[model samples]
Structure formats: C-alpha cells, structure tokens
Target: MKVKELEEHPTFAAVLPPATSEEYDTTGWRAFKPVVDKEKCTGCLICWVYCPEPAIIRTPDRKIEFDYKHCKGCGICEVECPVKAIKMVKEV
Candidate 1:
C-alpha cells in the first residue's frame, strides 16, 4: 500500500512489527484513554516518543494516531505534550 493510503486506512497491527506488546491486547487495562485535540496539537511528536508502550503512531501528515490495542493509558502522552493537546479522559 502507498504511504498516503496507509495513513488514511490505518491498520493497527500492520504498523508495528511483532513484539511483546503486539502479542497481547492491552486496551482493556486502562481506566482512561488519551484524546488528542487537533486544534492544539502541533504534531511535535513528543507524546509519540515518550510512550512506553510505543502505542502512539505518527502519520505521514505529521499528525498523531494511536494503537489503542497496546496502549496502557499510562498518561505519559498527556503529560509530555508541551501544547497540552492530549487529554486523558475516563474510558467508558
């Protein structure tokens, strides 16, 4: 698939290689989830870099995406975002 098409039609497991985190679905482990505010996001990639689970995905357009299946909702993304673009909201 072309880069543009891949960005538009994101497939979580395809983005990363097989690994420890990828082996299991960790989505249910978090009480909260990080939501990005596009208006405030500068695409600085800070959150993407600091995520321990490496759940953040940086798109070709410089925007950010998430691999929630492996995300633990550790809140590091929200805390590390300099622009405060990421907010951790309670997961319903």
Candidate 2:
C-alpha cells in the first residue's frame, strides 16, 4: 500500500485508459458554468487567470467573462477570486 509500491505496480498503470477525444466529448456535458455578480465584482481578473480550463476571459478594461463551452465548472476560479465575484452554479 506504500506510494512507492503502487508506483511500481503494473496493475495500477493498466487501470487507466488511453486518452481520446471521445472521452473528452462524453464528459463535456458534465461541465458547470460560473455565474458572476457584476455588482459585487471589483473588476479583478483573478478568476480569469486562475481557471485551469481557461474558461474565464479578461477584457481590455479588466472585466471578466466566462466561456461555458469549455468550462468544466471546477470551481477553482470561484474559490480563488479575492472579491468573491465568481459563483459556481450547476449547469442545467
């Protein structure tokens, strides 16, 4: 059960499947979209920069935008936003 032992096991390596676009497509529907409260926002771009999916965008004036198409709704941006501007709302 040690970390080193697990790393050396072929079974662990065999458990994972090879990457494919189908895998990505199938999971696309599960992604969440973030809702921003512009009234509460201070125009900070913390959410824009911290998003792992690059779902957040920053305008020339530092306004924030989210592209729900590619966003997995991981909530990292919402948790990292200093001004509490981003809220992770479940996608319907």
Candidate 3:
C-alpha cells in the first residue's frame, strides 16, 4: 500500500476518529525518561522553551517540573539545557 493510496481510501478515513482531542495518554510510547537535577539547574527555563510537548512547566517556586505522564521523552529538554541539568535515562 502506497502512502497516496492509503490517503485516498474513504473507508480508512471514516474508521479513524477525529484528531482534535487532547485527553489521550501517550506515556507508554516513551523509551526513556528525563530526570532533572535541581542542584545543577539554573532556572534558565531553556528546557521548558525547547520541549516539543510543552511538558515542562515552572512551579510556584520557579523550579521546573515535568508532566511525565504526557512527556514523550524526546530529549529536547536535555539538549536545550545550558547547565546540563536534565538527563535522559532508560525507562526501566
């Protein structure tokens, strides 16, 4: 099945649900989890800005927290952190 053919099929399109909902939990898809080191963190908020899922948020105390359940573990946080505070570890 070619990609073009699949898109043209009405049966496939009708069977699939709408893509507007945000309630789905995709936590199971992550192969690794990001762990943030509070001591090393400088409150730069770079991780929060680069996060594709926007799972990282600033707390009332200005500390960064992750919404682990919704986080896809894409490592954008780890890569964007200037202080190297966020580390991606195997989900075991």
- What local distance difference test score does each model get? 0.88, 0.71, 0.85
TM-scores, all candidates, are 0.75, 0.62, 0.73
lDDT tens digits, residues 33-72, model 3?
A: 9999999988888788888887887988778998886899
Score residue 89 of candidate 1 by CA lDDT.
94
Clashing pairs in 2: none
Candidate 2 runs further than 4 Å off: 1-31
Local accuracy of candidate 2 as per-residue lDDT tens digits, 1-92? 89999778676334555644323532365456688887888886777767776667776766877776566778888888888888777766
Q: What global local distance difference test value does model 1 have?
A: 0.88
- Top-scoring candidate (lDDT): 1
**What TM-score quantifies how close candidate 1 is to the native fold?**
0.75
Candidate 2 lDDT at 84 equals 86
